[model samples]
Target: MSIPTGRQILRLYRDLLRYGRQLQFTDKNYFARRIREEFKQAKNTEKVEDINFYFQRGLALLKNKRVV
Candidate 1:
């Protein structure tokens, strides 16, 4: 898969940030651990073409931010 653009990555990162913030009052470790585990599972797949998709998507979603 192609590398995501800075804007795309930023967008994804923002999503993760929001999710993290939402979970802050709860169990932050659990949220982080789940994300980690999901990534790990994605890594195990044998399809080379799709290997980066999961990471790229995650990064993109986590990085998005609204300019104030």
Candidate 2:
């Protein structure tokens, strides 16, 4: 499979942010910050496998009701 487009990636990011809001965390701010940091770390990803891996990982976390 091909890597997701930028818009698709942003949609996932937004979904993750929304998921963060939906979860009951003691430190919501910390959760949000962590999401931002993870995204930032992958900001320069160009490899298809790497990008899809992260995208699927995020989706799995979302589906399994966990955070990345």
Best by TM-score: 2
lDDT of 1: 0.57
What lDDT is reached at residue 15 by model 2?
89
Clashes of each: 14, 0
Tell me the TM-score of each prediction against the true structure. 0.47, 0.88
Residue pairs in clash, model 2 = none
Q: Which window of 10 residues has the lowest lDDT sum in candidate 2?
A: 22-31
lDDT, candidate 2, equals: 0.85
Tens digits of per-residue lDDT, candidate 1, 38-65, equal 6567645666456467655565554563
Candidate 1 at 42: error in angstroms? 1.5
lDDT of each: 0.57, 0.85
> Model 2, stretches more than 4 Å misplaced?
none
Lowest-lDDT window of 10 residues in candidate 1?
59-68
RMSD (CA, Å), each prediction: 6.9, 1.3
